[model samples]
Each structure stands twice: as structure tokens, then as C-alpha cells.
Target: MSFDYEKYIRPGKLPHIWCPGCGHGIVMKGLIRAMDALGMKKNNTAIVSGIGCASRLPGYIDCCTLHTTHGRAVAFATGIKMAKPEMQVLCVGGDGDGVAIGGNHFIHACRRNINITYLIMNNNIYGMTGGQFSPTTPTGAKASTTPYGNPDPPFDIAKLAIGAGATFVARGTAYHANQIEKLLVEAIRHKGFSVVEILDSCPTTYGRRNRFRSVVEMMNNLKEIAVSVQAAEHMSPEQMQGKVLTGVLYRDNRPEYVEEYQKVIEAAQDFAG
Candidate 1:
């Protein structure tokens, strides 16, 4: 049977505001499928996001959703996870919302090994708020703010997450729709801070400025540049220079922050006694 996506979506939230050829819709559908695969109930799941094109995802899902200010999604989601550790907490946002203004929160959450999943949809440009250049916008890429070319170095989000001590880190792309759900399911199942950086497309802003002929070209670029983690091991560094590795990138066994904090509470109680 075809996937019943309507059951997971909110009533009357149809017809999203995203522009045509946008991949945010695809990512949202994948998240729903992932939730279904895990048998997660709407009451038991809390999806949070910040201000951006991708941040609008939580508003459409039929779950406990928190839509916060720009770059505050992870900070808000962290608090939610700490209070209700049993709930499946997910933080969703675009590249700028995740790593630009919220970079500190993102790294600290990873360092604390908080048991929350963050899905960073990197479309290279800040598609919302006038299509400015974001932290993930590649060097030499053009944007509304950078008409000549962007001089800033782009961030490799997966590498940044791993370096910041996120216990589970993985990557997928809009072109690989089949793999997105699998990656999300694995990230949600992990016991510590988990991050899934999905390279998505923003054809309306990024493509138009960067001279991409169409959304198909952008999607095809993703397909051509992505190399699976397993497939990358066999290739030489030269062959992998321009390729991005997909799949689960790194995982480590770490003490989750919420469980550790509980110990502190117990210690305080015992001291009072």
C-alpha cells in the first residue's frame, strides 16, 4: 500500500509556502515516514524548528511542535528534551538557523551529548529573509547579498558536528529520498546527541543566483556529488576530493546529558538526607 502521509500531517496545513522546485517538502515527508517506521505517536513526539524556510516543517506535522525565533530551535529543543527525556525530540532548521546564529547552541548540545535529534537542511543559501549568504554557502558562490561572489568559507556540517562531539552524525541529500528516512530512523534511535545534515535544494534563491539552469540541475548536482560512506572507503582521496560522503558518518558511546543530570538531582537529595 502507498504510504498514508495525510495521517501524520496537520489538518488544513496543506499547500506549504515553499517555492516551486523546493526540496523542503521532500524532507518533511521523509521525517513523517521515519516517525511511522518507529511507531512514534504524535503525543510522544515533539518537533521543533526556528525561523526559516526549512523551519516551517514542524508547523505542518501533527505533533507537539515548537516554532521559535531565528536560530533558537536547538536551544528550545534542548530544554524540551531535558524536561521530557522520554519524548522523541527533533530539532529541524535550515543551515543558517542551525550553524550561523545558533552555532553555539548546536555545538554545546553536542558536547553535552543531549539525547535529541537535529536535522539540518543545508540548501547552501538562506532562502528566507531575502536570500542572503549563509555559513554553508560555498566560497565563490553568489547570493543576493553577494552579487559578485561570496568570500566566506562554507562549513561542512557533518564534520563540524563530529568535531563538536555529537555522538551520532550522518548525512543524506534531497536526491536520495529513499535514504533520508533510513538515516533519520537511525539518528533518532541513537542514545546521545544526533545530527542529520540533509543537503537539500533551494532552487528559487540559490539556483537563480548561482546560475543553475533549473531545479533538476541542482538535484542532479546533488546526485553526482554524493558518494556513499561504504563506497568512499575504496576510492582514493583524489577521487573523493569533490564528493560528499553520505550515510551514517560517525557514532560514539557517550553518557547522555539528561541521564547524567538525574544523578546530580539524586546527589542533592541524598545530601539533604
Candidate 2:
């Protein structure tokens, strides 16, 4: 049976603004499925996002959504999560919005290990903003701003999330649509801060500039280069070269920011009494 996506999407929001062949649509479908599987209540969930193609996801979803300023998704989501710890606050954004201008906020949110989930769509380019090279743009990749190819090294999103102290970190590619939902499900179920990086494709910008020939080729490349974490463990280091690891790369159980903050509040209340 086909899933009822309309139930989750806002009415009359169809004919989305995303360009044809963009992977953002696929990513959104995966999220909808994950939310359905988890029985997420739309009224009790707050979807927050910064400016970008991926961030626009919250606008189309039938939920309490916030389309905030550029690169401040995490910061705003943090405040929402703290103010209403009972709500499931999920932050969404693209590479530029989440890791470039929002880099400081991203890492600090991870450090706090707050009860919020961040879903970052790493298309490697700023698809919505002039096709500029983003923080995750691979060195030598072509973008509108990098006519001669990008000189800066790309960030390993999963590694950054783990290094920054996020309690849960996972990776999925748009090619593996099913895996995206699974990763998101696990991320949401985790207690503390969770980061799921979805390697999406911006066929209009990144693909056209990099000579991928077609969107299919770009998506095929993603499939060919991804290795599941379990499979990667059995492969030699040399064999794993040029291949990105998929699935949950890191997870830890620790004190969540909200619960810990409540302790301070309790102590203050006792002193006052």
C-alpha cells in the first residue's frame, strides 16, 4: 500500500519550489516515512530550519514549523527545545546553512547534547544561494563562485558531529532512500543531540557544474561510493578508499542539556525556599 504523504504535507503547498531532479524531494519523503513510523504527532512536533533549499522542508510539512534566518536553525531549535522539552524539535538545513555560517551554533548544540535532532542535507554546494561552494564542497569541485575549482578541503560531516560531542550521529545518501528513513528513525529515538547527515544531490547546480552528465549519474556515483559501516569493518583500509561510511557511525548515552539545566533550577528554588 502506498503511504499517505498528503496527511503530513500542508495543503496547497505542492508544486514545490525545488528544481527538477533535486534530491531534496526524496529526502523529504524519507522524513515523512520516518515520522509516520515513529507515530510522531504533528501538533507536538516543531520543525525548525534556516534558509536554504533543504530548510524549506519545514514550510511544506503540516506541523509547527519555523523558517528562521539563514544559518541559525540550530540556534533557534536549541531555544525551542529548551523552552518546550516535551516537544520533538527537529532542525533542518543544507550544508551552507548548517555548517558554514551556522558552524559555531552547530558545534555548540552538539556540545550541549540537547534533546533535539538535526537533519543536515549535505549537497556539497549552496544550491539555493548562487550555487556557491559550501563548507562540505569537495576540493576541486566546481561551483558558481569557484570557477577554477574549490581550493578548500571539505568537512567530513559525520566526523564533525562525533567530534563535537553529539550523542548520536548517522549518515545516509539520497540514493539509499530506505536507509535515510532508518537513520532518521534511529536518530529520533536517541535521547540526546542527534545529527543525521543526508548526502543529497543538487543536480541543477553541483551536477551541472561538475559535468555529472545527468542526475542519474550523480545519484549512481553516490551509491557506488557508499559502504555500510558493518561492511566497512570487514574491508581493508585500502579497499575503503574513496568510499563514505553510511549508517550510524557514533552514539553515546549522556546527560541531556535540559535535564541537567533543571537541576540548577531545582537547587535555586530550594535556596529561595
TM-score of every candidate relative to the true structure = 0.98, 0.98
Q: How much lDDT does each candidate structure score? A: 0.93, 0.93
Q: Which residue pairs in candidate 1 collide?
A: none
Model 2 Cα lDDT, one tens digit per residue, 153-216 = 9999889989999999999999999999999999999999999999989889999999899999
lDDT of 2 at 105: 96
Candidate 1 off by > 4 Å = none
Error of 2 at 143 (Å): 1.1
Model 1 Cα lDDT, one tens digit per residue, 149-193: 999999999999999999999999999998999999999999999
> What local lDDT score does residue 273 receive in model 2, on the 0 to 100 scale?
100
- Candidate 1 Cα lDDT to native: 0.93
